[model samples]
Target: MSIILFIILLLFLIGQQVFFEVFQILCYTDFRLIRNEESEMAFDGIVVANLAYELKEKLINGRISKIAQPETDELLLTVKSASGQYRLLISADASLPLLYLTDTNKPSPMTAPNFCMLLRKHISGGRIVDIYQPGLERIIHFKIEHLDELGDLCRKELIIEIMGKHSNIIFCSEDGKIIDSIKHVSAQMSSVREVLPGRDYFVPDTMSKADPLTVSFEEFSSHLTRKPMPVSKAIYTSFTGISPVTAEEICSLAEMDSSIAAKEYSEDLLLHLYTQFSIYLSAVKEHTFTPVIYFNGSEPKEFAALPLSHFSNYMPKEFSSISQVLETYYATRNQLTRIRQKSADLRHVVQTALERNRKKYDLQLRQLKDTESRDKYKVYGELINTYGYNVAPGEKKLEALNYYTNEIVSIPLDPVRTPQENAQRYFAKYNKQKRTFEALTVLCKETAEEISYLESVQTALDIALTENDLAEIKEELTNSGYIRRRYTKKKVKIKNKPLHYISSDGFHIYVGKNNLQNDQLTFHFAVGNDWWFHAKQAPGSHVIVRTNGAELPDTTFEEAARLAAYYSSMRGSDKVEIDYVEKKQVKKPGGGKPGFVVYYTNYSMVIDSNISQIRLCAD
Candidate 1:
């Protein structure tokens, strides 16, 4: 079975013995989409405790200067303190709830969300009094002190729950009465909890798990064997803050197989597991977190508050803060999700147009081949006219000699037609074939151009890293008639520019993200003395190198060629041929496609599409 299905089935069976809320770490459908594998990255109780310490140290006495809800379940809070201004991002999204200090900010709606407005009214400039975590549960309580409507001092709780789907940001009174939450869960939505205004606020303890820090060894072994499940599942299910990965780590430290049944473990094995669990508990108590991200190859595999010994196979990168670990680990994932969603529609549009144009191109080529014998029909007509005087009244054949090639030719004739009629028939056939060949030639070129243009758009989408890049690509497709334009009074201003890189030799290299940028880079931005590089006979970006009135270096040329190849459809090829020429030699066609250009004399080289050594200008 597939890993996703296996996880689903495993969790489903465990759900009978475990509460759905505690084990929600495994069952979110969107979590499967977040990573190709079962991601060991988690936001469990240990992480919450580490975050609690960081938040208390960083945010105590800080004033909430601004609040915005960029997404319905997300909050961006800018806090000002003696330390410095910091932005705290919190998400109550079910599938992937998160909390971190980030350098990036998202755009908010013109009209704020209702929960955002409520928080602004209650604690817009409130000072954070305390940041606490209740045991090891995935919840953070931010106690903010502010002046009420009557100018009286008051304290309120801004609790963020990192429970999947059940995750929420709750605004509550000092006495634990719920004011409002980012998400409402009534009896119909969830019988276990009701998170509505006027309702009492409390974290549900449906799992009734033992505290790993306080529980005795006998108690741990007794609670674990109660459920006949894997040792890893039993450990996580028996403890409040433990995730499956943490449980596996504990088992690995004990030199035990996590997949073995908890009921099968002997007393000695249980004691070994208990000792390892105590070590983790002691680490959490002493705050000895390494705060590192584990990378499998170049992709982030897992992140943790403590050192993960089993993940030693993966390269570990330590961070100064847990928030930095979270931010760094999710950075690539965030970009991928954002770009994927933005480019999905464009991919469909480009692919549909490509399929249609390719079909038309094939049909056009077939029809053009049928007209290949147009000259032969013309020869037949001439030969018949020259030899028609010898024809009988009902002749079925016409033989002629002394043709252009000096060879005898036989022409089939209509038996009941006269010589004049036969000549007219052959001449009509020749004229029709000649016209078809001429029309199909132009049609085939147009169809081929359309296919190439669409393919270039696809390549652009493939290499696009930012929403601005996708915006340019989408605009190109919309203007090219593959997508319909939505008539709006105000056009969204695009700040997209070509990707700028500096060669190892210190030359400036610019790569166009799409066809429009290609046009802008070539005809408008580049000077006549600059160098242009592109993948030969393939759909790709136009790479321009600025000479600045100096002699060109070979390294810059090769670096620019690498960029051209990396951003092309032929990027997977081991060696792609790149055509480079001086900007003066490249000419834009009168009304060709956006990226279409004609150049006669150009230099060609075969190079691999490895741009890792290339550096981009930070600006």
Candidate 2:
């Protein structure tokens, strides 16, 4: 029986396409999914609730010392308390709303926005007397105490609602009258509520879902059974603030198949589920947060405030605080999703330019091929000049000895013209063809180079992990005339830098992430003795190794080559050919594009595009 079970499991793994390291290998005794689908590292009620409790513990009486509106939908606040000064970031971006305590700061506009000015006026020096979440809904309410214009103590409410595209940050009076909001929703936009000034503040009804926190046993089972969907879907949809992943987790803890319909659940199954749900509900009431991030190999899969035993097949990494988990998960996810959204326009421009150049390059190559017969015209001219004098008048053909090939040749005669005129005509045709071939030779080379440069820009977009990287690529395109520059009063300073890696042998290797950075590293940062590595005949970053006048070990050389291969357009190949030479040997041509260089000689090696073994610099 054990051997038969092992065979079934092996077959399932092959069909799933997931690696053995992930949870796809995990199966129940009856072969049902413990969790049907893996969700994105989520920001749900559990995250918000855990965060509220953490804030309640840490920021009970913290005074708001400084406030700045960084993005239009975001705020950075500095709070000082008996504990220490901390920075909190709250963003209501429709696509990705988040609230977290951060250590970094963003640049604000020279002129404060209207909503920012209003917040400063009302709550600039307010003390956070209480921080709480009403239920499991994605909302946090801050009861702030401050002095009014007449120096009388007053109470105000600052609420942040993280409801995806409906997210908003609203300031309200003590009686729940809306004072102002960052994003206004009028009757025309949403029929549910109006969020303008003087309007009452209230959370939109969530399809009349029950609040899991205060629900009785009878309410839990009756509400869940009334739904006509899968048990997981019914659970989250029937309750406030609970997410689908959490619902599935509750079912897994109950040892029940979440794929089963809630309407089909028996009385005994309902009791088992309620027992599990109450256990987690009790944990929330007690404020027991065991935050952890689950990883599928090197990539983060999901995170939760409580331990998720259903994802036991995945690698769980526990963190000390929910703040740490939020920071780590979102930063990594932001690199994958947010940065792509931010750089979409830049990517579109690069893609359009690449398509145009590629078409032009293909057409030029075909035109260049038609000029191959130019040499044949030259041969015809020579043959006519050698033997046409002996041809009779109005003759059609002349058979003569061709000295070029040491063989007999037949030359056709235009009967209307003399032999000499025919030869001259052939010479003229040869000259025109020669001129076209010469012009096309140069044009093809230039067109090919333009295509290569555009491809390199495309690769840079894929490598970009932050806004700064996109800015550098955008600047390069503007200078190259691919994109028109947008006028802005403020000249935003770009602080883009190259990726630094430490070689296994302790040598420092720097890889440029974009064309401008590549130019800067190759021309200004690297010394004559430093070494440069690039993918041979490919569009790639310039990898510079700071040798410090010492000989590099073999390990360092291979690692540098791997960096070059990984950042290039040919990163998909099992092995990439790399060219490495001293920085002094690499030279930029006059009037060349950014990152375009010429090297006379170099050493070559074939290396794979794997740098997982390399250590990135802390900075």
Candidate 3:
């Protein structure tokens, strides 16, 4: 009996393993239901549906623990689930409407905004019963159950509609009576719909689009063929949920051109397009989603909750959760946008100074070019001194043998002065021009140096990721006299630090974001034996690799050079020359500008500015 039982147990284990393998295969299988080259980053209806599906799995039955409005058009909700805690961020900003889950916290105002206070009062301890997407539309509805002020059970619906400038977050009773909204839109503001308090809430039939989920093949074909527009446009315009991108995907999957007029397509091709569209809808119905982000080079180009086959030529990064994709994509995009906006002032300052310096340099160059003739004046003086006695009193010009070039040359003369006086006058003019040329040469070098320094500052601004990073750059500009220092009772403490990365060979690499940080890293943080790198003859960050008493691997050296090239002004170049040397070999000239280092001997390498393989280490 014991042996029989052991055999049965072994069989059960085998069956369990096979079942798990099948489940994994089902989860990861790619369904190429859609394909399109024209991509978008905007969260459309299909994306929202995927998000709603994922959120329902993780957030349903979760309790609302906290509510905060970090921005005027954004809300952050902390929800506690049986598995763990999650933060849901929603934004209805006119420029960017977004919803995602994140672990990062944003600072809120001291006093909560009126909308935030209202949400907190109603849903502080509410239990989320259902999270759903209403009709294949860009809208999410959250059903919450909570105890009212009288300690009675109550229900409310929080609806978020993501319709570009018409986006809003509305609170309503379970019976659909509007209570309030984050943004109040009156009849005067929008003739289609009024989002004001106490108004009956409803989705406006502005597009008059048919429901994609319930549409039959006959209806789909008739609706699309009736429009004399591009096939892609007809699909999106006729359906409530389909975006131009999705429509294009359907056309591509059907092996049809999306740009062709809908009526121009044959009946067979139209049937094929409808078939492909239905396959995608079927995947949505089955809750089979694969969140993928397509990249054009290193930057994210587009993202979707379904497999994007048209991006086959480009790199496609897959994610397990739609929320993860949304969070990463938007966070990166937002960081870039914020950096550009915040760095605008600094960029203008640097550009202005660079333009002025460039103009001055050009003028000095022209002046110096004019002084090139000063040598001829000196030669003229010597020639006149040698032949002054032969010159006639009233001669307007003197002809002399051109000894310098072995050619005869004519020298203009001032007949008003004596021959001896003419020679003295030419010598005086020669001396004045020589002095001007020398002084202008020094000024030109100074102006060029200023331009290079400002360019480095601009590169630093581009590399800055946080306000603290900007503060450090701003302080550097002030110290360098490009910006005037404002008088304050207390000085702002500097908290920004250099970026740290770990090479594949377990070596620590440091990249300086700004000039001040570069100086500090090279002079103080780096050791004598550490490897220092910079882009040769370009404005860039100083990259230092710590040796730590070990022989440096060739790969580490190459990675350091790549980092130096990537963080430089020549970032977009196909290849850049990098100079590397021992930290002790790099020296700062006396009274030189920040980040100005002179190295007589260094190793040089030409490399592409790709450091995606290197891992960044948080300091």
Per TM-score, the best of the predicted structures is 3
Compose the digit string of candidate 1's lDDT tens values, residues 1-619: 6977976886787775564654453444446445423333559899888999998889999999999999988999999988998999998876678898887989999999999999999999999999998888889999999999999999999999987657789999999999999988767556788999999988788999988878999899899888889999999998998998899899989989998898898998898889989988798888777798876423467888988888765567789999998888888667766788878988988888889889989999999999988888888888778889999989898878846999887788999999878988989999999999989999999899899888889999987888998888888888888778999999999998888888988999999989999999999999999999999999999999999999888898888998888789887577999999999999998889999999999999999886756776766
What would the per-residue lDDT of candidate 3 be over residues 97-206, giving only the tens digit for each residue? 78888898899999999999998999898999999997899999999999999999999999988876667899998888898899887654557888877888899888
Give lDDT tens digits, candidate 2, residues 132-152. 998888899999999989999
What would the TM-score be for candidate 3 when compared with the true structure?
Answer: 0.73
Q: Return the top candidate by lDDT.
A: 1
Q: Candidates' lDDT values, in order?
A: 0.87, 0.85, 0.86
| Residue pairs with backbone overlap in model 2 | none
Q: What's the lDDT for candidate 3?
A: 0.86
Candidate 2 wrong stretches, greater than 4 Å: 1-42, 61-80, 84-98, 102-129, 143-157, 171-183, 196-202, 205-364, 378-413, 450-498, 513-532, 545-562, 570-613
Model 1 Cα displacement at 587 (Å)? 4.8
Listed per model in order, the count of residue pairs whose N, CA or C atoms clash below 3 Å is: 1, 0, 0
Q: Order of all candidates by TM-score, from best down to worst?
A: 3, 1, 2
